[model samples]
Target: MKVLVAVATRHGATREIAESVAAALGTALTDAGVRSQVEVRDAGLVHSVEGLDAVVLGSAVYLGHWLEPARKLAESFADELGRVPVWLFSSGPVGEQKRPAEEPVVVEDLVRRLNARGHRLFGGRIDRRTLEFPERAVVAALRVADADNRDWPTIRAWGREIGTSLARLERSVS
Candidate 1:
């Protein structure tokens, strides 16, 4: 099986999350003795999904919306993606809440368009030092707090679930 893990990030936080998810998926699939190829890419750079068996796509959420590149990827590849299993994730939410301030506005539409198997909302990271001037202003204006709330164990478990499902899919096809 071949899997593509794609992400859209701002300030590299969501990229790290995507990497972690990819790594976890690779490990889980390998440990299960499942034969597979996994590749991680920036959403904007992935132009085709021709040979992939499954896809896991994620994006940074800002002001309750996915970043444009991630959204555009789903829009552009909806037909191809619908032919395979796809999972979506959103990363952005800080502070004690440890959940998104709101669901990303694009998720529902993408889920339907892509025929996505599942979607997850993961807590995000915020660093004032990395913020551009306008981002900083928005953060300050919104009183957003700084924190890294990504749950590694949960992420790993989700990856394992995907690995298991793919293994079953491979079996059924074989």
Candidate 2:
């Protein structure tokens, strides 16, 4: 099995999430006795999805919006992506309090355009030291503390689900 995990991240939090998902997915596929090759790449750097059995695409959400690179990737590869099993995820919404209840505005449209099998929303991390002007100012204004709010268990479970799906798919085809 061949899988691609393409992600667009700002300050690398979303990338970390992508890595975790990739790791878990790889482990699960191994446990299922399905030999697999999974590549995690920057969404902007990927030019094609040829021969990929599945794809997991994700982006970092900022102010209810997905970063431009990810959106462009989906738009650029819509036709090719639609032919395979694709999953989507968004990483953002950080706080000591409850995570945001709203999904990124563009998620639904991309999911439909790509015929994505599912979408997940994962909590994000904020490190004040990494922030630039407006973001730092905004964090200061909102008094949002620097923290990593991502839930590993849920993220891993989601990855395992995709792995399970792929194993079933492989069996059906064989």
Candidate 3:
């Protein structure tokens, strides 16, 4: 089985999340005695979802929306994605306030459209120094603090679950 772990990120935090997921999934699949390959790439670099066993696509959320590249990928491959096991995740929500209580609106819609089996909303990180002027201004205006709120254990567990599910699927087919 081959799994593509694709992500659309702004300022790279979301990409780190994708890497963690890919690592955990690969380890889980190996532990399950499943022969599998996992590839992590930027969502924009993925031209197609064809010839894949499963996909774990994620994006960074800002202002209740997913990044355009991730949304475009899902929309372009809706048919192909619907046929395979796909999971979606978003890295957003920083600070103790975690202002955005709801997941990105795009994720909910994509889940229905693509039949994604699972979706996770993970806490994100913010480093004011890395932000562009506009982004920094917005963060200051919102009174959001710079912090890394990602939960490594929870992220890994989610990836492991997906790996286990894929292993079961592979066993059934074999």
Candidate 4:
């Protein structure tokens, strides 16, 4: 199975998460007696899913919303994705906010409407120097610390779940 893991990142944090997910999924696929390959690509550059058996689309949260390229991909491929098996994930929420700020609006809602197998929120990271003035100030005022909050074990488990579901879907198709 060819799995495409596409992500939009501002400063490479989300991209790393996407890569980790793909790696975990690839391992699961191998264990499931399937030859699977996963690739990490920029969200905007992904124009086709012709040869892909499954896809995982993820984005970094910025002010409670997905990045522009991530949103564009969903809107552009909504119908196609509806016909295919897809999972969505979001990476954000660093430094413990009152409300889990990483909740992505676009992908999460679309997953419900599209009947996607799952939608997950993976912990994310924020580098203080990467932020713009306003964003930096907001983080500072909110006392958001600069740290990498990605939980690898949790992410790996979710990826394995997705892999298991994909294997099931493949069986159903056969």
Candidate 5:
């Protein structure tokens, strides 16, 4: 099986999250005794989705919206994505509130368009040093503190679930 894990990140935090997810999926698939390959890429850098079996796409949310590149990827690949098993994730929401914020309006539409198998919302990270002037200003305005809220266990467990499902599909096809 071939899986693509794509993400759109602003300040690298989301990229790290994507890496973690890809690694977890790879590990799970391997543990299941399934021969699989997973590729992690920036959504903007992926020009094609051909030959992929499944996809896990995620984005960093800002002001309750996914970044433009991630949004464009979903819009441009809607038809192709609909043919495969796809999972969506959003990494945003800082501070003491660790729960995932609501799905962005555009992302909600993409979910329907792609008929995504599932969507998960993960907590995000905020680093004061990484913020540019405007981002820092917005953080200050919102009183959002610097923190990393990603839950590794939850992410790994979800990856395992995806692996299990893919393995079942692979078995059924054979």
Candidate 6:
């Protein structure tokens, strides 16, 4: 399968998460001994998803909402996405607050309406040193501590599951 992992990010945290997801997927496919392709791109710039067997769309949340470009990509590709398999993820929750879902989230709901197979939430990062003056003040006022919350093992597991699911889908279609 050819999988595209498209994500929108700010402060580069989300991009790092997206890259991890893509790498995990690539490793999974290789381990499965399957001939597959995986690529990562910024959701805002992906003009086409043609010939892809699966797509994973994700975004970084800001103020409890996904970035505009990520939402735009999902909305614009809704029709094409419905015809194939899709997964959705978000990199947002910080610190110990980041946990896997036991219920549906808003972005996941949107993904479901677009026919996505699953939606996931991954922990994000916050670097106090990298924040601008205004951003720094906001974090301080909000009492947000600086940390990298990404979980590599969890990400890899999710990718393996996606690869397994897509492989099964391919088998069924064939």
Q: In candidate 4, what are the lDDT values of residues 1-174, reduced to their tens digit? A: 889999989889889888888888888888887777789899999998777788898888877789999888888887777777888888877776522544566766778765677888877887888888988999889888888878888888888888888877777877
Can you tell me which runs of candidate 3 are displaced by over 4 Å? Answer: 97-100
lDDT of each: 0.88, 0.92, 0.92, 0.82, 0.89, 0.81
Steric overlap count per candidate? 0, 0, 0, 0, 0, 0
Clashes of 6: 0
Clashing pairs in 5: none
- The superposed Cα distance between candidate 3 and the true structure at residue 26, in angstroms, equals 0.6
How does residue 64 of candidate 3 score in lDDT?
84
How displaced is residue 172 in candidate 4, in Å? 3.1
Q: Considering every candidate listed, which one attains the maximal TM-score?
A: 3
Give residue 21's lDDT in candidate 3 (0 to 100).
Answer: 96
For model 5, give the 10-residue run with minimal summed lDDT: 99-108
Cα lDDT for residue 145, candidate 2: 89
> Residue-wise lDDT of candidate 5 within 1-174, one digit each (tens)?
999999999899888878888888888788878899999999999899999999999999888889988998998999999999999989987877887657766677888899999988889999999999999999999898899999988987887888888888888888
- Which residue pairs does candidate 1 place in steric collision? none
Better of 4 and 5 by TM-score: 5
lDDT of 3 by residue, 1-174 (tens): 899999999899999999999999999999999988899999999997888999999999999899999999999999999999999999987868543467788888999999999899999999998999999999999998999988899999999999999999989999
Q: State model 3's lDDT.
A: 0.92
Global Cα lDDT for candidate 2: 0.92
Candidate 3 positional error at 123, Å: 0.3
Native-to-model Cα distance after best TM-score fit, residue 148 in candidate 4, in Å: 1.8
Q: Where is model 1 more than 4 Å wrong at Cα?
A: none
For residues 7-57, what per-residue lDDT tens digits would candidate 6 score against the true structure?
998788888778888887777777766778899999999998789888998
